[model samples]
Target: MSAATVSSSPKITEKMARESPAEQAQVLVKSRICNPNFIFSIFSNPPDSNYSKLKYIISSSLTEACNNSVLLLGPRGCGKVAILELVLEDLLEEYPDMISVIKLNGLLHCDHNCALKEISRQLCQEHQLLFSKMASFDDNAQFMVSMLRECGLAHKTIIFVLDEFDLFAQGKQLFLYSLLDAMQSVTSQAVVIGISCRLDADQLLEKRVRSRFSHRKLLFLPPSREDTERLLEHILLLPTNSSFPHEYVTAFNVKLLKIFADYKFKEIVDTLSYSDSTVNHLQRFLFSTVSHMDLKSGLLSLENFKAALSTIQRQPKLEVLKDCSILELYILVCMKRLEAKEQELRNFNAIMKEYKSIHDTFQTSNYYARNVCLRAFEHLLQRELISFEDNRGHGQSAEFRPVKLLISRPELYQGLKSYPSCPVSSF
Candidate 1:
């Protein structure tokens, strides 16, 4: 395929570059192991502002061997988890024997008991300590505290990293508060890092819980266009062989079709920071291009890339909807209905009323207070499932422009009808 076929190019999304194991290790750039730019895709400037801050925090915390809490905040697909992994790498090297790092994702351990049990399980697995599973929350809580305290008294550094941190913010504050308290204790040289997609997740904390995490906070901004472009280039370049040229043409049916984006595929690269659809589609194109690369020529020609592209079947992305809460699903139902009616710039109050109407219609016992509805609205906004325009107005007259549905509204609602509490069950 040539450039004409993919004129509107899209960026390489997180799923494309970072997650897919085949692409993660092999498909990306042939850059050397030591190149800092290529080391982290979409991270253009080595030691940029956020990097420097995070590096400094890691260095300071390591050198001091004292308790420190850091909260990393960023939007989805923005690389908060990556930064934490980098920090963990440093820890692995710097204090192999003296430190124990436990990484937990809030998504999987949303329940208070689950989180506690996970901690105990991991500790035992790591050290081969055979302890009976604490059956009760109190027992588990005490078990976790005792283990941490023992580690601290032994002059060992304990690090707990919780990603998707906002989930933990909603339930009982005990786990969070306890972690922070362990960190600050005079005997425990522990560190707690909470990575959240919410910019103001700290607000969800009780005053006491909030106080522990107030020490350090860093927000990772989305990567820029240039950074993204370079990231793709770095990831694409192969030292041994070229899969395809930056631009290529393919023969589709009887005509020559250009399967390219961004003119030079820049269009595809530019959207990396914002669009997941673009990423999903582009990943297929790249994979196809690479697979069709000629072995003897050691390069992928337009013919090879196109032949591969022609065979790829596009798949629907409905997993996002499957992961929505009941409240969030109802909110999506409301936004979708409003969008179907061509209603634009409706404020929160208007959406809330619509949501209630839909909720009541469902004949379910799900109860969402106004605050809960608002929370779901904000969460939906963050996920980019629903988007609204700010009319630059606030208070009584604030007009929130049309709530646009990025995902297939009909499909999402169908998923809801089939399984409303799919994601909530995990919590």
Candidate 2:
């Protein structure tokens, strides 16, 4: 049996190796499209050209061993962090020996004591110093200051990346004060780069803390429709100068361009633009598109895009209904029937009455007791599929409380269409 299995493995390997050149090219194309770094590399900077400004200012500051501070402000998923990271990554590669990076997030180290301890830990790890947890905040702060002074003497540039900077600006802001104060007091070549979603993050700082800050702020905004279109082209269009075979690249690009021109594809892109016009959103959308590709097709299509877009834009209520029990769906259907009759005050009792009428009239099998139906009704209420009127804490029992269907008529119809054995017609 072992010998037979060994022999059969080669057959499997041979079958896998039989994939065509086009299929292999498609695999590479999918990989490139899904690669966040590759996608970010193709990022079209805004008209203000923040990417260049970041690269130039940070690079020049590092080169001169000068201390500088900058804040990056933007809404979440607006590529503020991505742009900064790309610039920092390139700079680190260029000056590997000269640069040492320390990353801190306000979510994790917003407290002054925690920030100090984290600074000590990161500093010790980066410099290969034996780290001992300090017994007090003062000891930790002192150790960090000494470490910064030592780093300066060694001609090393420390780059501090503070994410969610607004959180760190709360309370006494001892973390910000000590950090900015260190930049002024010590001779260390350091760059304080703060990234925050809050546009007014700078204004949150105390006067003492704000005084120490360099006051340079960069604002990031969502990509425009034209920018989003350009991004799509860069992501989906195969580069002519790529290492891929000319025929494969040309063929893929042709197909991609045709897809781009298609109104359906354009509409999908437009819909996404109106929802979340971010690089991250576009990548997520493409991730779904690539997920639908297979060796047989070996190419992306409008159908794949449509399916992916539909998945992303699916209704939450419909999705919830799909996961519901048949009994629960029955309760929903009862509510729907009651709604169709334009019944006022469709409370749990009223809905249960409608359910029994249908059950008796149709003589439906697999009968659920009133208690089971009540439990299902309560579940629907929990999911907010049904909501109670402002009659809570009244003398009436929970069953008599007036409720309304949260879902629309069309949603009920669509949700039931895909549900197996829904028995929607029994109503």
Candidate 3:
């Protein structure tokens, strides 16, 4: 028998497929670490729809391993990846002897043949299969498919996971089609879960690939504003170092904790809300929040989250973005939506067109006066946030280029989540 595959986290583990019960238990001991950074530990009872789905999926995966083929769809930073990690961990524990897993990222193997060969390589290496040393790509892939099927028929399980799944759709869905197609004839079952960040990824799938699982999917929508607050609140209230032996402690600082305790829900949302940020990304950002602040008897202030956000995205100083005002953010949003290239000199007329279109769409009559807009544009130039071909003059209507876009469109969208209630929303 084979064993577990590659791992992203130390907690989601695999034991030798045919190892003794004692040996398998030993392999899983690593999961007992008490550090809160282990995301699989923090995944306990999240306040969202994923809990039920995870319960069902974990149960079904243990019961019917091979036949599970899930397509997880969501945007960046969402907890889509974490959800899968939990599922894999559960399956590993439930079917130590029967299950063996391999996870690969779509971005790593954009080519279909490369993707297959890589998957085959990982499986072979872990299982000590003869295909590990095989030279021919076609021969190795076929052997892998056969071995996976044979395992299923033998009442053993094989799980294949592809992250960044959209990238793997390149080769006519060759890798996906081959792996999934083989699962049908096998008796026990095998699973192939593909995860993608693209919203339109399903539409890009070829009919054959789509037909592999008859169009099965798991959509991971962005968290609602209320859910975002709950998530942050949960993180804020997570056990600190002295909070006792919680399996996973939330990363909190004394300074930050005090503010969270005192801030109203609306007040918290006004400060900490980030657009397009998922639990995964937020968790990562949260991990670094303590490092950004001073740790003293004084509790952390809400103002510190601004530094964390700026640091997370490698953006310019938060003050640079703060100086630009909401209308400035709207201008950045317009430019980004229009796909303004960094290399090209953007024309003022083009930007105004986008701004006009945005106002018409959102039905807002709150555009800044042309003079105010031009001054804002000139101010951006003075701050070195943007550039113009004629660097000598404040030519508002001329073509200009963004030199230091402190906040990107996606980040701006995130910032806009608390808009209108925003500091400069009044103007």
After TM-score superposition, the amount by which residue 369's alpha carbon in candidate 3 deviates from its true location, in angstroms, is 13
Q: Is candidate 2 or candidate 3 better by lDDT?
A: 2
Instruction: State the weakest 10-residue window (summed lDDT) of model 1.
Output: 248-257
Clash count list over all predictions: 21, 0, 8
TM-score between candidate 1 and the true structure: 0.57
Ten-residue stretch with the least lDDT total in model 2: 1-10
lDDT of 1 by residue, 1-427 (tens): 2111211222356665444333432334222222332234334235655656775676666567677778899766556676566656655766687778787888898787788888878888877887566467777777777777787777677778888888888866778876677566666677778899798877888888987775578987665655544444443443222222323212211121132332534433333222333333434555665666554444444565445433452214356666777777767666667766777556577778776665566655776788777778878777777666643434533224445667764356446645835422110
Deviation of model 2 at 236, angstroms:
1.9
Report residue 150 deviation for candidate 3 (angstroms). Answer: 1.9
Q: How does model 1 fare in lDDT?
A: 0.60
As for TM-score, the candidate ahead, 1 or 2, is: 2
Show the lowest summed lDDT stretch of 10 residues, model 3. Answer: 1-10
Best of the two (1, 2) by lDDT: 2
Q: Give me the runs in candidate 2 sitting further than 4 Å from their true place.
A: 1-19, 44-48, 241-245, 319-427
Assess every candidate by TM-score.
Answer: 0.57, 0.70, 0.63
lDDT of 3 at 308: 64
Q: Which stretches of candidate 3 lie over 4 Å from their true place?
A: 1-48, 61-66, 132-134, 238-258, 261-269, 274-276, 292-426
